[model samples]
Target chain A: MANTETALKDVMSSIDGAIGVALVDYNSGMALGTLGGSAELDLNVAAAGNTDVVRAKVRAIELLNLKEAIEDILISLNTQYHLIRPLTGRSGKGLFLYLALDRSRANLAMARHQLKRIEAELEV
Target chain B: MKRTLRQFTGRRPPVLIDPELLAGPGLLDELSGLRARVPHLTGSLVATTDGLVVAHDTRGLEPSGVAALTAAALGVGARLAEATGQGEFRELLTRGELGYTATYAAGSFVVLTLLAGPDANIGRLHLEARRAGRRIAELSDAVLARQDRD
Candidate 1:
């Protein structure tokens, strides 16, 4: 199993146009680890805001009364792509991998594929 | 099309209830209306923050099991998101070989789950679902309040 930090670093380096990457806890809206964000982009605040998004979606699902599993959430912005992937493995429940990329240089399909790979190898 | 939550609740009594500071009744009609719009959307559900089933379409699936699974997934997803330092998780989508499953936020009180076949148009589905989820949150808040009044 890949250590969390090394696994994260590998993903960051492999993906082009990756502006930032983080491991976040949707439950508490906290970032356990982060890399590559600059002065204008604060990973902590982004983690909290995204937590709201996750919470809201889960609530809506309950109201509708559907039975399904969530894999990943992709937010396509004008110039960016925010990918929120919920870890499904037993060891990684309640955790997610968030990746931010510049649209111009990022390949969404490849990015998603790579993230899944990283998730498989990550050691929690 | 528009339907009132009163009309829906009158027709189908909710399966469960939990009181809290949240949205109200108008939200339910909006959820029903949303269900009406999506053709391939097999079902939808709302669960509390702790992952209890609040309400559901319940076409043929087990409501409690779904809620438990969603809650478990949410826990893992949240942890993975934090471990990587990417920030808070906004949503999660699982694309299985057979179908697709998605979870979205509905304020602080609930989570929305959408299950669709391979043919479902993801882009359009996401847009409509998000709108519907918000409407439900508002309705849930109202419903909780009405119960309080009684």
Candidate 2:
């Protein structure tokens, strides 16, 4: 299986305008691997922070009794786009790829497309 | 080992209920009514913060388990919002392969959760669900308050 580092690297480079990326575990609120974060934007903190978002969504789904798998979660902001792609592969369950992109520099549609592709390729 | 034991023996918060209110099926009926109003809604439920099912209209689903999971998620959501200075926890929505699941904080100790088909109008779902959740919260609180007074 490809390692978390390589998967994270691929995410940061392949997505245009990527400011930071992390492979996060929603259950524990930890980042398994991270890349491209700035001093002001810590990927570790972001990873931990987004864990809540993922867990919350999952819980809601369970409560609602919807029989489906989550594709991805998109949070748009004034200056950025935060994309959370939950890894659904056999080995990647409970893990997610968090990508932060500059709104002005990134193409939202392309970013989603690329992230989906990357998620498919991600081994762990 | 200690942690595991603690988990097993953890003190669960008591469920706030008004026997008089729940003796009938009013809450469940209300939830069913909400489902009818939202064309795409597949199911709906009201659960305690500790994940105990109070009322539900979901089909083929285990209400107690879902409520517990919702409580876990709510803990994380509330902390996440507070830590990030995003304000109080209000709602959560997850879009899935087959459809959407949405949850709203109904009141201090309850949550309202809904399921919708893929074709459901998101804006409309949010609008209707929010209104229904608020009403449910008020009804629940009133029931509890009156019981306490008596």
Candidate 3:
């Protein structure tokens, strides 16, 4: 069980062209932990705004009566890839891991694979 | 005693009462059962698709807010699903600074939301939530039917 800080550090080092990482709770729009964000990119605000995105999607599913589960959410910007992975551990409900990668320097497949590995090793 | 009897039998009760045929037991138990099966399920709640609370195992978090949020997420998820021509909207994942929120469709009557830490297992969470969602849907359908009758 790697601690939160260690887990964040490991993710930062492992992912190429990583810009920032955050752990957010969509329910309250709160950021539990964050790393690698620049002045231009405020992870806190991004987390909150993303909360709305998550909420909207959930609501839409109910209205449509579609029964399924979400694997992940990818937000593609002109220069960045915003990846959202919802944690599924007993100690980490209502929480998510958000990663931002520079489009030029990152491989989407490898990044996703690495994030999944990091998620498995992260101790709440 | 007379007042109590009148309240119980007269004008109908305020709460929905389901018959034996429709009423299913062990809702909280079922939620707990999911927890046991999915060790990473930090928390789980059953709420109506319309945002009504059914049962929850939230530590100190507000169940009402959860229901509302879940309903909202389902809405957008459905749109994305349709826009992409996906068969149905089943689950939604939201990443944040602190953690992640995953909402799964537990049938038409309910949804299950899971909160997990940064390092929690994503694959396992998806699998467990899906299984739990199915069970919750069955249970919620039964409960909703009863509520309708009442």
Please give each candidate's TM-score.
Answer: 0.46, 0.48, 0.45
Error of 1 at A113 (Å): 0.4
Residue-by-residue lDDT tens digits, candidate 1, B13-68: 23345633333355445557667875467877777645677767758899778877
Q: Once superposed on the true structure, which residue ranges of model 1 sit more than 4 Å away at CA?
A: B1-150
DockQ of each: 0.03, 0.02, 0.03
lDDT of 3 by residue, B60-83 (tens): 799889888887677667767766
Model 2 quality (TM-score): 0.48
Q: Locate the minimum summed-lDDT window of 10 residues in model 3 chain B.
A: B1-10
B1-150: candidate 2 lDDT, tens digit per residue? 001111111343344543335323667777878877666689888886666778888899887787788878777777677678887778888889898888887755667888888766554566667777778777766665666577
Candidate 2 Cα deviation (angstroms), residue A36 = 40
Off by over 4 Å in 2: A1-124, B1-24
State the weakest 10-residue window (summed lDDT) of model 1 chain B: B1-10
Q: Taking the tens digit of each residue's C-alpha lDDT, what string does model 1 give over A35-74?
A: 8888977777677667667767878888889786667899
Model 2 docking tier (incorrect/acceptable/medium/high): incorrect
Assign candidate 1 its CAPRI class.
incorrect
**Overall lDDT per candidate, in order of appearance:** 0.72, 0.76, 0.72
**Residue A96 lDDT (model 2):** 92
Q: Quote the positional error of residue B73 for candidate 1 in Å.
A: 37
* True-structure RMSD for candidate 1: 14.4
Among these predictions, the greatest lDDT belongs to 2
